[model samples]
Target: MKLARLGVLIDEAAMKRLHSYGLNVFERYIEEILEHAGAPFETITDIRALDDRGFDIVIASVVPENEETAERLWQYAEHGGTLIAYGGLGLLARRLGCRQRPRTGAGYARLPEFRSVPAPLRCLSAQPWHAEDAGAGAIGALHASSPQGELVGPALQTFAVGRGAIHRWAVDIPTTVVQLQQGTRPVLHDGIPAPDGTADIDEGILKADDDIELDWEWDREKTATGMPYFAYPHADYWREALMAHLVRCALAKDRTLPLLDYWPEGTGHVALISFDSDFNEDERAVVTLDVLKKLQIPSTWCMIEPGYSPQVYERVLAEGHELALHYNALEKENGIWSLEEFTRQRQWVQSATGLARVVSNKNHYTRYEGWGELFRWCEANGIAADQTRGPTKRGNVGFLFGTCHPYFPIAWCDEGNRRYDVLEIGFLTQDLNHPNLSDTTVIEPFLKQVAKVGGVAHFLFHQIHIHRLEPVRQAIREVVGKARQMGFAFWTSKQINDWQRARRTMRVTGIDAAGQVRLERGTVNEPVAVWLPTSEAPESIQSPGIVYRYGVPCIKQVHHLTREEAEC
Candidate 1:
């Protein structure tokens, strides 16, 4: 069977905002989601030439560039081409079963078919539209809370044209996903009120968690510890739903797309345990190391100033654990948030540990000030991964930053929305057993949701807690055990950074008309997983670099293939 090809139509005007905002939700950000899904697609700017190219399905990420473009899209759908309008359908409003709603207010949206998980209605402000029910059935609906109480209307709907259909999303899926992932620009200081004292909001520094837009009541669920728990990754869910719909459209056209598995060896998901080595407590480090040794799992130890003894560092290296830097930018401990301080501390740790380079870092107390300065410093210091973006308050635990997936952040101050060399691996919460922070109740749900979203479930533990608190120790053991039972492999921060960077280079070179896919990767130190959607298992397979294959049941039938670097 032949696989259908997809074309992503983007507004060049909207993408121009990348210069100021670092990224535009409707443009580069949406493309990132599609790339991660491993869906074969082409970006088209000229809608006039779209009819000539053989694209089975088209995603109008832009609200019709002009009248000609809008007419062309409607004709394409009428002539048997699947068209998915991301947000604004402009001229095709009445044709696609939607009437413009003249109102702007705060609201929440839920897809009943998708477990009724609620997400903020972003499209209402962009282009408010309600379903007309003129041959189209609503797939999802939104409840807008204005001064006039609440108004319920259709949020998502699909209707057939001549031979094909058009699926419209009123929530501006791309914008919502991007906002959830990157968060808003921290202009001056605080965004969310930290009444729990987890952070000193009045300090006038914009911490990573401060940029989070999740509402305490609307986005989080109540926990056993009475803390606000973010069980659902609204952004990732939107991305997943968008991709699932695209895949279904392709399948309807007798096509299949390839997807890159999140973990190595076809692992369902991954979990990472990291420690902030506060005050260089070598004795406490030993106790934590003992527990990890008992479990035979490697961990990442972030070294603060005046780190552990040389012997302890040697032991950590010998035990296959990673040694990383814990940057302290707090004012109380004579800390300074500056590039000079970062370079100084980075140099001290590297010299003390006898290492030429340190690959990872986590800030002390998650102290952040500016927007992209931390990322710039990381790139300058050659640090590949940073784990500071997470919930400092117990109320913000679980997907606080809207993702567990590590990604290279775009330099907000840089031109062309250029990405930094550093990959941010945002932690979920600090010290699960901490009374003022989090508890064990979130472990199972957090890990499960992360696995569903196919990202790392990274948790932070301080050496001080591990040494002083028995509950913390037990919590660590339980979390690791549960993750293992759920098919999650534990990995250190360095390992994750290495694997993710290596896999980023892997590209789908081509997919033939006969559904055969060709992939290309640069020289990598480890093997990567590539999955292909198939209706049936192949009796025999022949592909270089792929050393093993496994059958894994998912939303669809897929064969998981592990592709290793070929022998030189």
Candidate 2:
């Protein structure tokens, strides 16, 4: 099989060092680009020879300002050459075409202090962004050093490439933290190097480009199916690297990867079958509850009680599983509940948990989005999470093609009624699959699949699934055992239960004339993203707000709604 050739068009020491880290054929001062990724190619190095060889990609790693190399490769050869250029990149962008993307996206974790572009290009691209055990990566940002003092980041600027198909910050992803002397490119966020000419992203932090590999270790644990679930995030290091490579590949000025909380994490997909229930107080609930108690596994219950069985619902509370008002009352109406009728059902939940239901309804028969009015009512009433976007009572799948996980609700618990305050937790599995174990006994396969996609198994197990699956129940114990053996951690659903609980407190305190935060409640262990209304600063929230009782920042924003609408 013929392999594709990649040209390394540089003679500089820096270029030589950089090429060592990449894969594929490296051409020095290659004249032409690889014409295709179709098949392997015979090797050729002469710059002029590139025209005849028909290579597809060219990696220009030298001082792009050097007109000789730029003119040769820039003019001749393949339609698009993947260029690893610096100065020449912007120039090519102008020729190849370019546009503006708002700085609002993602990729820039450490924002450069000054928006000003310095005089010289001197900066480090590597600075550790996480804890020591958090593994490591080659962090790159644009930095500059002046004839003056220390180096700092370049100013902020966005440039489009490839007819607006791609976007690059001129966004500095440099590893050198050296102070760049001005005359730098558009990546406005720049930083300068220290006195020593030595500047890597965070200067001197990274030594020997050979040791640099773009990989980060995710703290991993196993899902019930014994597949790995990473507790921490992967792709933090590679995502930006991949984006840069992608832009370089497109050879377009418009190429850009979102720095916003993008979806690099949810790529994997699958679901689990729960083996427990929360609605009835029959032996089914008792048997299922006993196993969950013995196994130390936390499950979610779809509770159904119209002041009928307080002990049953209360037992779910005592059993240590999440409680969602199961719509038994509304099941007859095609499992749909009227807003007011739904309210009466969960009215007794306070007796169970002593707190207003923070989570919403999960319809029985595994129906999805059945009780819309009930959900809306729950939302208006102080609830913030809903788990109804799964199989309806018919136990049908495939209506959901691929998506499975927690997503922001398109609307409140109400159909077609949107609310930003609610978090929609979708159901991935239920108890029916266990007894039917037929072909859809996807308990393990689904769990394994969901784990692959960085998803949680939001199961609605009834008393039957576990209590009956003698072997399967034992299998649950083994799954937990294997997880512990593999260094994975299991979290009680209530912990996340609380996380959803805390999200509602976010408020827009006051807007600056620039629309920056005059006030925002900086709570503990939460995602607090504050943006300038102008959108320049976007939304930036850091840990430790003024609310911190202990010098550490913590507290809620002032201003609370007088009363919340009613919910289950």
Output the number of the TM-score-best candidate: 1
1-568: candidate 1 lDDT, tens digit per residue: 4556788886465456444565444345566777666566788865666788878888887533567877888888999998987667768887666778764445666565544233443322334576666578677666665212365566667778899888877667766665666665643576656555544445555567767766555566766756667777766667766766665566667666666666655556888999999877789888988888998889899999888999899989999899999998888888998999999999999999999999999998788866678888998899999999887777778986667888776645344555678888988877988777778988988987887678889989988898999999998998989999998888999999988877766666666665556666654444455555444434344433332122222222233334434443
- The residue-level lDDT of candidate 2 at 222 comes to 35
lDDT of each: 0.72, 0.36
Q: lDDT by residue for model 2 over 230-316, one digit each (tens)?
A: 222121122223233432333232221111111112212322224324434466667767776776766656555532255655776
Model 2 alpha-carbon miss at residue 350, Å? 3.1
